[model samples]
Target: MDRNSLIMSLPFRTSSPPLNWSSADCCNWEGIACDPRVAYNNLTNITGAIKILMRCKFLSVVLIGENFFHETIPSDDSIAHSNGFRNVQHLSIIGCHLTGQIPMWLSNLKKLKILRLNHNRITGSIPGWFSTLPRLKHLALTHNHFSGEFPKELCALPALISAQALENDTNTSILPLFSIFGRTIYQYNSVSSLWPGISLRNNSLGGKIPIEIGRLKLIRELDLSNNNFSGNIPSQMSELTNMERLDLSANRLSGEIPISLANLNFLAKFSVANNNLSGPIPSGTQLQTFSPLAYDGNAGLCGSPLPKECTHTVKSNKDKKTQDEKVGGHRIPWFQITVVLGFITGFWGVCSSLVLNCNWRNAYFQFLENLGDQLYVTMAVSWARLLRRLL
Candidate 1:
């Protein structure tokens, strides 16, 4: 087909399609172009629906923002037969009012480097097949209703430089699965589902902090305020060697502050107030830099930044120690003396009772012996008198 015939076959939105077009007129069509690199090649097509398609081989960028193009993007299987845009490297369809799920055919663009589809009502989870795009660098899908867990496969992309996915309440557990520089950041939040590393400031996320979150060594900004997270801050969070901003305010966390958190060398903005946390605040170099507002509204917390000092904790510890020492010092000797005196007194009383009973028995035995001897003598005298009378 000639260049004009090819341009006429392509879909366009107008009252009536153009009918008259000469070979020379093909160069003037709104979306037609000819390859200048080749002396006689007339490759006519559309790009971004605005610029005339000249030199299809050399067409590298396509910007189709705010266009009236209305058609369901074909599936990957159908695009091979539909003669889809083959060579574009960058494609942006922002604010196009496009409807329906992201077509699987978009993955067919092997040369696509950047894809921007923000500010549209695109529904559906990000395609799992996007991992096939090796050269895809920048992906922007913010301000959409794409609901699901943060795709781990996307993070595994070797070429992904920047990724922006915010404002979606995808009901997936994001804490335990999240690993930035081999550290977990949602260690104490019990929320079954979390949007860790994202700006999830205003949402209905409820749960306790995952204890495995102290591993994100490279996280700079963490905004998890205005949620319903509760639990003690994990002491292992001190491992975030490069954390700069942390916001755990307006939640329901409780427990003594971990002393190990003072090891964070780069923490600048920190807040964990409006919760039920108790005990003294953690102290050290980075912790000293936080303002009073960082730990406000927690009535049970006390320390330097807070007006309530931890004298009770110190006093309680000291009192326990003193009581333990006093009990230890007095108990052994007193117990030993009581046991020894009891044994001696019990032996002397038994010996005195035996001696008195023996003396009484001895006197009674002497009196009985003398009475027996007198009875024997009286019986002998009576027998002698009776014998003499008989003689």
Candidate 2:
């Protein structure tokens, strides 16, 4: 099929008319911009993109993922020096055994709408320049080795902060970006590729989650799970009135869950498990509608949905520790009891032999009597001998 026919078969702008094969020249079709340089939507089976791919002046989409090249992402001076994939809208390189940092030249993708590099071995900090991409959306870096605090500016992206909800008609990516065992996180059709959100799950990114994140008012998915993020969740996150899924599990976050989270009426998926979060779960909200396992691994959390009830007389950590110590103090030492039992057994065994056998008792007494007589005779003889010598 011709390039135009292929592009038409996949999702593009909803306004694009149905392909009329009756027409000879595709250029005559409505909304068909015949720009000679615009050869886009490359879905090739190449192992790795060579330098020439970066030089394509009008290539619009690059989706090459799920391969076993074991090679670092290829780069060259063209990407660093000139407009690099300037018109590219979607870029995905997932599960390619890719290593090394994301090339800094990606900042050249001023028009990039979606970026997915999950399931690779990429390391190094997330580039701060990512926030500068005005049209960027739907970033996924899950299952990588990215570390360091997220750039606060990332949470302030104009598209994420105030982008209107996707209408039913907008075109989205032609391929699946996030999948587990062939199950995709989102469906193949009607879901916008430019969904306003981010996922950094299963990385080493640390530091307090940026309070600026609450500004993403229209974001649908926000996942920072299985990282080292700490500190209290921002109460301002409740402002995300349109959020559908929010996961902060397996982090070091402490303090009470923001009671304001109860206001997340649109939240379908939520988890805060395996954190240092404490206190009663906020009452009378959708938070209680979730499974108790959603709140598991937090020792200090209590109340509805959990087996631990919040008590009027709350105990402090010090008090609980002292009570535990007192209980431990009363435990009997088994080693000392064993020693006492051994001593009693030995004493009883000897005493029982003498009492049970008359011969043993008589022999014992006779030996004592003989020893006493011998000692007395020796003393008398010694005294008589001394007296004779004196006379």
Candidate 3:
């Protein structure tokens, strides 16, 4: 098809006709990016025959999301000779009417970083080739009907930082032991890729989480919530020191929480609620710091943070012993005793000084009165003797 006809067929075309498609001037077209140097040469040479498909090599982004492009992507007919979306780094086809299995050819886009295909009716097992995309950092394939055991290869991508594959059910088991006739069979043979952080919540996945998952040391978030997963949370997960969020809620997991989880000091959110777990919750920095709500709904759990305290008789005896030690260790210091004595002595000294001062003042007044009386008597006797002699 001609480039103009193909462009017109795109669901993104608006009612207002695109800028004059009379000539192949991609620079004047909206949503059409072209190499400036190519456009400059084409403008000067006045060559209107150069197709945009040939000139779109310099395209950096292609946004066809939410445009109701209902059809299989990378269809053999549609992608026969075109590399239109080859160089584009971000591909978001969210809520598009697209269907069919995820294309294996999508793994060929080496530069793709973000692939969002959420909220669609897409079905089929997740392609194993997805692990080969080296630059893939964000992937969202939620709200689809994908089936099969979780692809272990996708968890091996080194550059995979965030992945969301929630709300899907694996219709078949990938366990080699369960395959028909004891012949070792590989269900999906694609390259091995590892993702650091992933979400596989609300799926029909049942079985123990693979112990190999702990190898993802850089993983920060892991959500396997609302699944039929059964077994103790792997102690190996303590190696994920960088993990910040962990949600394994609504599972059938049982057993005491692993003490090793306390080693994850960077953990900010931890939830194992709605599980069949029992025994005292692990104690230590990370576990103790979590609110009771994070460990709630486990009927058999008991500890300091939880309302159900430990019921072991030995614990009560230990508490009593510690209390006795504390009480016995409470001894009054000599300095405090000295301080109390000093206060009492100082109070008595002040009272005695007041009484002595009062007594001295009264005695001084009485002595002055006695001396005055004696002086008056001497004066009167002398005056009377002088009067008689004069008479």
Give all TM-scores, in the order shown: 0.43, 0.64, 0.56
lDDT for each residue of candidate 2 in 1-391, tens digit (9 for 90 to 100) = 3444444443343544556623544445455543322222343322223333444555556656765346776555555676556667677777776788888778887767778888888898988788788767689999999999977888866667655423232434344343342354643431254456799999999999888888888788899999999999999899999888899999999999888998789988999999999999998999998999999999999988999999878799988866665654684566798999999999999889989999998998899999999999999999999999999
The CA lDDT at 122 in model 1 is 64
Best by lDDT: 2
**Decreasing lDDT order of the candidates:** 2, 3, 1
The lDDT of each candidate is 0.56, 0.74, 0.62
Instruction: Evaluate model 1: give its TM-score.
Output: 0.43
Question: Residue 302 in model 1: shift from native, Å?
Answer: 0.8
Best by TM-score: 2
Better of 2 and 3 by lDDT: 2
Q: How many residue pairs clash in each candidate?
A: 22, 0, 7
